[model samples]
Target: MSEPLLSIHDFSVTYDVDPPVHAVKGVTLELARGEILGLAGESGCGKTTLAYGVQRLLKAPAVITNGSVMFHDASGEDVDINALGAEEMRRFRWDKISMVFQGAMNSLNPVAQIGSQLEDVFEVHRPEMTPRQRRSEVADLLELVRVGAQRARSFPHELSGGMRQRVMIAMALALRPQLMVMDEPTTALDVLVQREIIRQISQLRHEFGFSVIFITHDLPLLLEITDRIAIMREGEIVEVGRAEQIWTDPQDAYTRTLLSSFPRLTGERGVVVR
Candidate 1:
């Protein structure tokens, strides 16, 4: 197999506080080119924290105790991302790697139009593009994410939650990043809308050709989309394997129990009733 595009080795993060919360504990994972790896876990289990750790985007009081996140660039440079300076990281954030935050519907500016918000991504990362080029790029991005170009003129509040999420995906794709991190990309929406967004995300990945780290707590949904799944608990990974394999034969007790909790309709072993 080709070398993974991103590798997190022995990564751990601890927050500096009175009790010193340990968010992630020695977690290691990899994402190869065009691969989709889902990080599934309950809240407080460190999935989001680990995403922040990989990009070195953790805020103050969050300390990386040990280990490193290495990004293997297309040019064959293995960049130790943990050591990247803020300026380099700023450059890397969009062009090299992009992240789609949970509740990205709320992330868009209330005052700004969707086109302007998408333009902001292009502005920050591709500042040299002419105004015409920027508009073309923004329009194209909106189309790519399955949002009508007309919606670009609308505000985030004017659109539905799913549309806003698609806009976020469009913004994340503006740079054609090699890796995209999605944390709970489809939470809080009704079932139909969530399914629509997830389907769109999968289709867009096929169209754009980028690796994705899709994080969510929903096991049934994650199983449908991701190639591989990493099951986490208590700040550590309990299992990591292909979706079908884990669904059929989870070796870890915790993983099996979690599977039991999410019984799929077109079911197999994991979804089997007691």
Candidate 2:
């Protein structure tokens, strides 16, 4: 097998409370370089928690109780992300790994123009770039996501939801990170917009050669776009397999349940149930 771009071993996270909720439990998985790995489960199954935990984006009360997240970068350097200090971690984020957060359309700065927000990513990360260069780069990023460059002058509210979503994606791709952690990127959009977002993500992944850790509750979409799928339930990864294998020959009962949850329009219904 190829060297994994990222590897998680026995990872666990817990929310500290009167009765602590174990959010993620001993989940182990691997994401290969330039591959799309989907984390599929029903809502509150710890899918988002796992993604946040791996990226070290968890807030207080959500403690990572165990395990290691090892990231192998293109430079042939292998580092345990858990070991990085705050400054190093800050530098690591966005430049090496970026996230397109869930409900990203809402995440954009409502007060800022799209150009200013996109330019901020470079201003922070690529501070050495001249002002003209930053503007050029921001325009390119907007175009990369298929949003018109003129839309850069528009406020977040001025753009449609789909356009705002595309803007979020463009911002995430600004630094050309080696891996992207996208948490339910298509959530709350219409079916056609969702499909378009998925198509753009897949296209960009292929064109840019970056691996993706795609987190979503939809198994059907995962099967369509990801190379591999990991099914999570109650904070645990109950199944991990090739996308096709998970669809055709699921080993775990929970996997089958998630598969059956999305009904096919044409296929015989009973066939999937059995």
Candidate 3:
């Protein structure tokens, strides 16, 4: 195992609505170097909230009420992300940690070419690089994510959903971040394409050595790709265990319901469809 990279110590979140809703409730988790930790829960269960909060992306209405999210830098310093100011977080956001968000395709500039948009990352974080160097790195990133280098010149509108997602993955990896937060990475992708992306990401994690926080709703899919899983419900993590162990022996009723929900193509559920 590699060094401990990030720690979320008993984190909880609350929304400051008319009647405040607690989203994340005392959730404690950690990720080691090169590890993949999956956050599994249904919609509105705060999986994405936790991921975005770790990256300091929460808005005004939503507030982190308790706990600390510490980022262990490559220099061996522990930086508390929640305590940082706006400018400080700007320095850390994409350079040390990155996110491949659910709406990442639309996050790209509609008017800009894909490679030029990717160059913005380099421009902000790696300003020393010339335009030529930035373009070279963008091409390399495309290849790293198993996409053709030529697609870099095209705008986001020209690409399919899978292709756009692949571009987002490439952009996330461009900085060679030590940790990445991915929420429903293959959300709009076909099952086959989703599998391909998952396989590539797992391979890249092995090759490049970055810890991943994977958020998704598919248990069978998560079972196939993740190292560990934190099964969550109504804003709480009920069980945590190794992926294989959880798949075989889930400790929570919510976890069991989720496991049973997977449509096994050859099982009883399949009989109805076939």
Q: Give residue 120's lDDT in candidate 3 (0 to 100).
A: 92
What's the CA error at residue 155 for candidate 1, in Å? Answer: 1.0
Over 66-112, each residue of candidate 1 has an lDDT whose tens digit, in order, gives: 88899999898999998889899989987889999988888899999
Model 2 residue 38 lDDT score: 92
Off by over 4 Å in 1: 263-274
lDDT of 2 at 176: 94
State each model's CA lDDT, in order.
0.88, 0.91, 0.88
Error of 3 at 226 (Å): 0.3
Report the lDDT of model 1 for residue 104.
84
**How well is each residue in 153-249 modelled by candidate 2, as lDDT tens digits?**
9999999999999999998899999999999889779999999989998899889999999999877888989999999999999999999999899
Candidate 1 lDDT (Cα, whole model)? Answer: 0.88
Clashes per candidate, residues 3 or more apart or on different chains: 0, 0, 0
Rank candidates by lDDT, best first.
2, 1, 3
TM-score of model 2 relative to the true fold? 0.96
Best by lDDT: 2
- lDDT of candidate model 3 versus the reference: 0.88
Ranking by TM-score: 2, 3, 1
- Candidate 3 or 2, higher lDDT: 2
